[model samples]
Target: MTAVPEEQPAWRQRAVERSTRAAKLRAEQRVQRFLDAAQELIAEKRTTDFTVQEVVDRSKQSLRSFYQHFDGKHELLLALFEDALSKSAAEIRETAGSQSDPLQALRLAVEMLFEQSLSNPGVERPLFSDFALQLLVKHPAQVATAHLPLHQVFTELVEQAEDAGVIPAGKPRRQASILMQTVMFVAQGNGVPAGSHAAAVSAEEVWQFCLGGLSGVPVRN
Candidate 1:
């Protein structure tokens, strides 16, 4: 009947929609796999030394799927760098918020952030590598956007500490940014760097030693 044809078209459209959703879901999963594989390789090697074929194999996804998700390894590395920076910055804010005092919170925030460098970035890697750094630097606005959350936390804490007479009055955000950058580079990847010197130096030890220079006066624990 004519009525049956109209109903059949609606049914077909629904089926097509369902099929499209399933395909999209599969593509996203494949993308995640590729990202994980790339992260593993980059962390261990400190460079994009691995090949696209290797990442595709590790992801258990086909080369076509890999290309669909990323144009190439450079794009994948950029995603990872942006992701890691934003993720770590958010964590620092959360951790720093839990401290009793602004100074203490700042220290905790710094120590926790310092863990990010623990990925063992030797001279070869040196944080995002020159190639990746150059790419990220080109997108300064994006980089700053990713860092804004952590910067805001620092700015707020600096204001609080200054108002409470905990720290000297100065450019709170600028000072905070400098401090955060210093601590972030202290460790290698995302935790405290491991070594004889690092082993002997506890996070608290580092904090106490630098307190005088940081506070310009003795700070109580």
Candidate 2:
């Protein structure tokens, strides 16, 4: 509890600041290295194809350091997918919440879907395609896995529409499912040529189409 001195030396203060900054920079660099390694490995093959050691080597970091940032491979892959979903959800939440009209909210939600697909190409390739297929096909038990928080956001949007009388009063879950399928189809509709209409279609176009379906004349409510 004794004070070291009335005033610290300038050089010592500078050294302390430099050390703190360096530590922060190192942490940031390590995260980037980890993500870069993940992207490189995922590009080459599926999730099952890569190991912790391979990721560390690709990152040019020690295995111990990799463990410092992540508990294990499962944790890392979950983190990667969750991060992408979180970003997309933020945009969707903002778009959906800010709009007064239910149709606008639906449009924004759809737009968020396409935007997420485009922004995170690396994730879209694995999670939306292969990982999703594997979880549904090879591992039915896995399909019952915890609902991604992002999906909850989508469900909430459906609930809002139902309350607003934009959608049918009953079967909110079914309505949400239909909307989810439409978004998924458009987002995962790859393989089309660049010049084609669907290929050229913007996120806005997807949003408009979805909004039309949700708000069609004969209100189901």
Candidate 3:
């Protein structure tokens, strides 16, 4: 018969648990450092062409730590992208939630999105140019997952609008999706040439077009 192992004391067990928790916290800090370094490089270079080694160097973390946390560069980028969009979704939701009118809430959300895309070209440019497009093409499912938070916010606004009779009684979620796509298309024009007509489009114009579509009215110039 195999010998029975001795049980750990309660105090010892509690100490072990505390050690594990501390280790997990440190690991999370290391992961965040890697992410922050990668974001800094992307902003500085205005592209996502940098390497994992570069991120490691910038983060002051080891290669082993990065690999331990992430599979590789693509995985890191995906994490960073998800984190960013999630934060943006939260901010937009908060802002929209403050508005009394559903239509105004929706408009404010769209305007904020457009403004972010334009104002923070350093981060937004690389995100939209490389990571987002690549994910859309190769990992459409991941794209949908990453975009879910923002989509949900829009859907909620659309539902509110429909309930308030500001929009027609139809598929609110589908309408929200269409509106999101429309806004993103126009916002992505931030990557266009500075003097081009596409680049000339403003957030107000985008909002006006979306409002017109939502209300079934022709947009006036």
Candidate 4:
């Protein structure tokens, strides 16, 4: 046999490495596909009877592949919660940071949250599928963890406003907790009951309500 060139072996090695990398990438994609499919189903229908097999079928991935990525349905649900929190937190940071005025930033942040709740009604549906409801019913720790980022951002903004003499300095944590609670109450469809349908509040309404409660006036225009 003719001697194989060194470059040929090196090229084969690179090809093998690439194939391994592609496998890993595909694995990651499958994991995300499952998560996306689960969220879509949960968003469209009820999560009361959702199952891992359902997710696998929706994602077009094998059940074995699903287990390779997640421990079980509970684990997958927790992952979904964490993913939602991460996405919401990132959006909050970006929207809030873009506003120079602290109060306006806070309002915008709240509005963005309201919009998200509306868009993902199944996830945030006041009586249907409260984000906090599931956590309170199944996993309190997850709910507590989810509040951390919201609390942090709210506390920071409150403290900053205090420093600027925009709002009276007091207990930031207490204030943030109250704000979160109020938002949840509104999101949970507790504001009022409409005929056959529940009252759906808009982001502007939430922003105004929060502003009023905090004694914060919307920045001019």
Candidate 5:
């Protein structure tokens, strides 16, 4: 007959559970510290060229600690990219929700995205150009997963607008996706130098164009 293992005493079991929870909390704190450090470096340098050792040094954590949480710099960047997009989505959702009209809400969301790109070019530019672009080329699936939150919010607003007859009766999800892509393309180009061959487009103009496209009405300046 196989022998059965003895169960731990109640007090010992409780102590072990508490210890496990504490360890998990500490691990999470360590990861946050590393992430914060990397984000700070990216903002300060206006680029993603910082090294893993730099992150370790900034976080005041050992290389071993960083490796314990992340495999490499690419993994860390991916984590930061996902976190940033998720937070952006939340902010857009909250801001858009404040408006009673669905069309106005969608417009506000688009304006907010453009404003962020213009106002925070240092951070947003590098993130999209250096990290997001590369991720799109190499790991498209990951990009889609990270972008889902923002896309979902846009889809909800589009659906609301369609139901209200503010927009044409068509594919709300497709419309939302197009709106997102158009806004992103414009926002990404906002960093172009003033003297570049590309003509500068104002945020209001972009919004008007989008509104016209959805309503199937010509927008008059």
Candidate 6:
């Protein structure tokens, strides 16, 4: 019988590549744990007062591992903002998928996003609130980079709707940006004056108005 040949070089290279990928995934998971822990802490206290050490303890991860993923607490907050935006976008996409009409899907996405902000108390105030947004304004690079994923999702949905003839041809990205900015204020309750008799418009109403403008459909009262 012929002797079996030793493992091929390409095979060894592939094995090393797989090992590297596994290590990368594990590192990401650890980083995500820290963000999740931070969110939980904010929820518990309804504020961003917790220390990095407390986040590390909540994550059950070593300080060394935390440093490996993020430079400092501020960087970690940037990561948290990015992660929350991405998660919110994903959920909106999932809910919007149930609709057959592309225009309705776009509206559904907006409704779902607003509902998510309302469902999580800390979410609205921590990341998307006007007060929080002002703090991030100085870090334009970080904010722009972190917000790109959510922007992409919103822009894509609008483009698809227009392409499907669900809405008239217009500047999809511009529309998406305007819609996103407007919804944040609406969700943060900024539009309603405190102790006023004015009725704040619902997310559905906002969506209908947007649809009316884009598709020339009449807005329902």
Q: Mark the 10 consecutive residues where model 2 has the least summed lDDT.
A: 119-128
Cα TM-score of candidate 3:
0.86
Q: Please state the error at residue 132 of candidate 6 in Å.
A: 3.9
Cα lDDT computed for each candidate against the true fold: 0.68, 0.67, 0.83, 0.72, 0.83, 0.75
lDDT of 1: 0.68
Clashes of each: 11, 0, 0, 1, 0, 0
> Of the candidates numbered 2 and 5, which has the greater lDDT value?
5
Q: Which candidate is the best by TM-score?
A: 3
Q: What is the lDDT of residue 135 in candidate 3?
A: 74
lDDT of 4 by residue, 18-84 (tens): 9999999998899899988887888777553587888999999899999898888877777776667
Across residues 151-218, which tens digit of lDDT does each residue of candidate 6 receive? 77789889989899778889988888887767765666735676764676677876776677777778
For model 2 the TM-score comes to 0.59
C-alpha root-mean-square deviation, each candidate = 7.2, 8.0, 3.4, 7.4, 3.1, 5.4
TM-score of every candidate relative to the true structure: 0.65, 0.59, 0.86, 0.71, 0.85, 0.78
Model 3 C-alpha lDDT per residue in residues 1-221, reported as the tens digit of each score: 99999999999999999999999999999999998898899889877889999999999989998999998998898888788778889999999999999989999998887776553537543244556778788778877788899889999998999899988877878888898888876676555776545446788889999888888889976
What is candidate 6's CA lDDT for residue 58?
Answer: 98
Task: State residue 66's C-alpha deviation in candidate 5, in Å.
Answer: 1.5
Better of 4 and 5 by TM-score: 5
Q: Which ten residues in a row have the lowest lDDT in candidate 6?
A: 123-132
Give the candidates in order of lDDT, highest first.
3, 5, 6, 4, 1, 2
Please provide, for model 2 over 118-176, each residue's C-alpha lDDT reduced to its tens digit, 9 standing for 90 to 100: 42334443244545544455445534342255576777887787788876665656666
